[model samples]
Target chain A: MIGYLDFVIALALAGAMAVMLTRLCLGPSLYDRILAVNSFGTKTVLFLSVFAIMVGRADGVDIALLYALINFIATIAILKFFRYRSLDVALSQMTKRIDQVEGGQ
Target chain B: MANLDLTQYLDYALIAMLVVVGIAIIRMKNLFAIVMLTGTYSLLSAAWFVSLDAVDVAFTEAAVGAGISTVLMLGAMLLTARDCKPEGKARHIVALLVVVITGAALLYALGDMPIYGDPNSPVNAYVGMDYVAMTPNDINVPNIVTAVLASYRGFDTLGETFVVFTAGLGVALLLGLGGRKEEEN
Candidate 1:
């Protein structure tokens, strides 16, 4: 019974991933693609967890945990790169630059 | 039995998704979108690897492919044009012909391969079975994967770590080791 539920969950996640892929490919705006990619990564994490349960292996959950952490870091890095246009910029400098712009306004 | 069939279907669906993502990545003009799609592609591959019971490979793919590669590509994108220049149809046709030939050759080779999970397969019948049997007695590690990587294959893992260290050193040197900044007093 539990295995059947896991199977259904896995199938649903796969379907959702297909939809996300479609959104990614047809997306006109860059943000759409970024969101789709991040969402897909999230789904992958969930799918890995479900698959691990289905297969009766506990190792898949560990990988899923790692994936979730990496996915977040990657998303943040991408967003930061887009915002600052440079990854090497110091956070202090970024905050000061933002302050200066806000002060001028 | 029923659940096994469902998992198999999931595997096929994931593979189909991978193919579609690969085609989309090749056809896309926007560099940023392409990078994102590549991340999606990597995540899909990681999921597929998990389904195949290759949790360790899936972990590496998730970390390197989905995480590090995406950030690296985004960094590289900063130095390049937003949109890729359109290529000629002739080039596409030539590339397609090469891909078709290589794929055909691989498919032909696949026919000679042993069935998946066959205990009689050459790979499963050899040293691998020995390791599986010996791990509990010799290494006493609960997870055979960890035991094999850290103990039996320790030298190979050490070499891989050394290679990674060298790559990190090279990157640091190239970037002037400026990963962090010291605040002015």
Candidate 2:
């Protein structure tokens, strides 16, 4: 009863996952891409858990939990690293170009 | 017969919510709105699982997908920009093709699956009996889901944990010591 219904729900959500993938591929900004990927991760967790029931295996639940943790931690870390090494920071950095422009120009 | 009962009504409701959330994730221009759609997607999925009598699976999905994943996405958003750049920017044919191919292959394979809840199905014959038959001495856990996950399939769960550890290590390496703005003090 509920099993078939769950299958329908999982299927519909998978459709959403497809849309998120579009954003990940066609994102206009880095943050958009990050958000899309995070959305994808959340869906993956649900997909795995539903799969556990579809197959009657409890192991899938454990795997979903592991995946969810990984997705969250990775998103934050990547964003932080980007900020630390942003292109603006690179342009502002002291270099030979600064000396040459300051001295010659 | 049983599926056509109240369960179908519930199923229709869940499917409606799922479709709505799916559209929200894609159509929303706001980054937070998209992230939030993902959260609702998780909760709806958890509810779906619960309806299916897989409460343990529902619990995990609710906790991890609805809980931790949202926080991480928010943190990631904070670390960088918020609003997405203007739309209509990048090429995406390859990814679409891949997703389509994969979905098609899976659906084709699933067509051969045994009937739902068939009594003579191998899953019911070879597998389902153990949970009912072996609770007393073979595994001590009252909850069959816990027993199967922790003992019967213990090694597989450990492998999953290993993957989480690996990801955590990777995040630690990537972020270093950077914190939010004004935290430099």
**Top-lDDT structure, candidate number:** 1
The 10 consecutive residues of candidate 2 chain B with the worst lDDT sum are B176-185
For each candidate, how many residue pairs have backbone atoms clashing (under 3 Å)?
0, 0
Error of 1 at A76 (Å): 1.0
DockQ for every prediction shown: 0.50, 0.07
| Cand. 1 Cα-lDDT | 0.80
B27-78: candidate 2 lDDT, tens digit per residue: 6667755665676577667756765666666656655666556656666665
Error of 2 at B54 (Å): 1.6
For candidate 1, what is the total of clashing residue pairs?
Answer: 0
Candidate 1: deviation at residue B9, Å? 1.2
**Which stretches of candidate 1 lie above 4 Å from their native place?**
A97-105, B159-185
TM-score of each: 0.87, 0.54
Candidate number with greatest TM-score: 1
Tens digit of per-residue lDDT, candidate 1, span B1-185: 66667789999999999999999988887788888888888888988888887776786677778877877887898798888898899999999999999999999999999998798998899999999999999999999988988899999878757654654443343233344575542
